[model samples]
Target: MSTREEILFELGITPRWKLRDVAEIESSEETSSSEDLHKGAISSNASGDWSELKTTIESCDRCKLCESRKKVVVGVGDPAANWLFIGEGPGAEEDERGEPFVGRAGQLLDNMLLAMRLNRRENVYIANVVKCRPPGNRNPEPDEVDACSSFLDQQIDLIAPQVIVLLGKVAAHRVIGGDGTLASYRGVEHRYKNISTVVTYHPAYLLRNQLDKAKAWKDLCFAMDLMDKKIEQRK
Candidate 1:
């Protein structure tokens, strides 16, 4: 199969000609002393400290999510990635695996990353607004998001990514902070911690609404342009 076809097959999506035309895309903390982190004491020096952060998340009880979760999906990928993708929260597969995006949705995400010439293990990082899987894979409550805010914040500081792609409404609401629909947030550049941010449907959503994959592709193109501009500004 052709490279493009292979990607579509992996995504389990059929090629949309317009999307094909735009075929471009775009795509932590550390603990500290446990007490310090639990008390919301983020160490400035803790930026890029993955080990400490992982320890904290594993034992986190900041919200009810920790109560039922099998494992904490701390996040995965390059510590100092240029691209950061944030999602809502972990699901059953992710909770069991202790990693984010390992199910079919994750497979689609991988294909999406591949389309953008990025990879989770490369200069890209993937995380969620909340570390633990919500019971029944439901949307995380505001308090749950509030509980994990500091951890996610520390991750942003540590990664210092030039561009962030919020992979659904929950992430957009948590990161960008407004009562906006996912469509309203798309096609525009938002800022979080001064990092350029783009919003798009989550891979899981895309799987359910295949027709929207074209829209997702367009969002990705916008994100790619944002990333390109950021790179240019650095130069």
Candidate 2:
């Protein structure tokens, strides 16, 4: 069996299905070369310097979230990563640590990255839709998201990842700009700023709904497939 089939078997997804053709993605008019998008994103931002961006995020008071947050989770991992993972927002632990996904959910995410043969220290970068933690880990308000959206956009432009994986409904909604349910977005190809994108359950959600782990694995497999094809195209 092929690697894809093996992964499907291990994940308990019977009768392995074929991934969507890379050609379809290539043919899409919305698709642009990753290099072009990267350049476009950098140019669009007034100050593309990483340090300056972090400083801006640090001093940002566009929303009331800054008042309650202990530290702004600026994001962590390789500055020039190929895989960008975007989560909803920071939780308590993340707020305290000033990093994204450093709690129990973060541990699971690390395992997920290992499964994909990637890691935080390698070709992977992680960030959140909202940098500050909600008062009580609640969903970030729309106004708060609007306040922080440009920073996230700057991060995406700077990283220029080959594929973007949206971790939950909020990220899916924020990046992909849709009101659709998470279920509707999963197992399908999406795009953000002309880059290939995938959606999957958040590790925190998977922790609560253990049964969905298999589905999440499938989503990872799909993302891996997309990454492979993108890499192949670059060759």
Candidate 3:
């Protein structure tokens, strides 16, 4: 505590707060308030209460990425999807369409799903580790990714999919603990809160590399196999 900071603290100025710091403080306050407001003893109510949270994210100013967004790109796919796909974030087509995976990459994904007897929009639900697009399709900044993570958590809670397939290094990094190598992480099963999760190469990566599609296919097959096993075990 410098003399100036001490005095400012007494005056409640926080004059030293940078734009980023001020934004973070405001975000913290808002989160605290929301937690208090949603403090029901029942876990079901807390688990189910995300409509308001989603709306708040739609108009969020918590990060600089929000400034460039055309639409919120909340998420897409069946709310009750047995298989959930988590990716890095929205790409150009996703941003333009306000849904995840709608470009050439998306086409490849569609074909891959169709082969597995799954439909992109009907059978499977898709979300991103992030809800916003990075500028120039670059990777999300760490701070930006952190800021939007709770939204993904909420999506996972609402869906409660039997298996989660994390596509690409980014989603895998968040969902599966590792040294951040897709090669190392893919095809392995991990626990995400409660659901079974596997990491896979993104469809976009498959489109670019082509060869990796074989590997991606294998990962998807593993996910489906596990899903079936779970069902059989339950029965």
Candidate 4:
């Protein structure tokens, strides 16, 4: 009957999706944020003019958000990783740290990956849809996500992660298709260029909401399962 439960119902997924602990997420926010980030999104597979793509995003001005950006967070992960994770964009801490998921959020993300036995140096990759952090850590405007679309697509083609985990609303909307509300979506498999995608709350959200850790744990388990299955398939 809570917001998290409401989201699970909307997604029509049982088990992990129904984590009714709204208070945990409510408490988890450093200040509620979003991406054009992805499951620690990777750019290894991008196609169509890497040179042009780099030039394009490097000088992007399609959205007002571009003017205030510190750096365009393209992505960081093993180019050969078979799994991809995406979130929205950088936060103030991320902007300052210049590393994806480095602050409190990043530390939690590292824990999430640890739950799945994924090491940042291996087995996974990370990125945001829009590299720059929006002013005041606001939701990325659609126009901003659009400007960065080329890089995202290329990253997909380049990395070719068989399994992709969408970490937050911005990443969810980009990789799957939704308004990016955990209150309305999670626990279902969405598709991106024919790859399997799972949605979950952002690490920052988890940090604020300790009670939902178990539910988030379920998501972590599922992700590990999918990755394991994919790894087996390569055999």
Using TM-score as the measure, the top candidate is: 1
lDDT of 2: 0.79
Q: Model 2: which residue pairs collide?
A: none
Residue-by-residue lDDT tens digits, candidate 1, 124-220: 8899999999988899999999999999998988888778999999999999888788889998998887878999999999989988887787787
Tens digit of lDDT per residue, candidate 2, span 2-90?
34334334434334433422233234324555423222222122225999999999999999999999999999987777789999999
Off by over 4 Å in 2: 1-48
lDDT of 4 by residue, 78-112 (tens): 76666788889988877766567888888667666
> Stretches of candidate 4 above 4 Å error?
1-56
On TM-score, the stronger of 1 and 4 is 1
Count clashing pairs, candidate 3: 0
- Candidate 1: which pairs clash? 30-53, 31-52, 31-53
Q: Estimate each model's TM-score.
A: 0.84, 0.81, 0.77, 0.74
* Superposed Cα deviation of residue 6, candidate 3 (Å): 70
Residue 226 accuracy (lDDT) in model 4: 64
Cα error, residue 212 of model 4, in Å, equals 1.4
Using TM-score as the yardstick, the better of models 1 and 3 is: 1
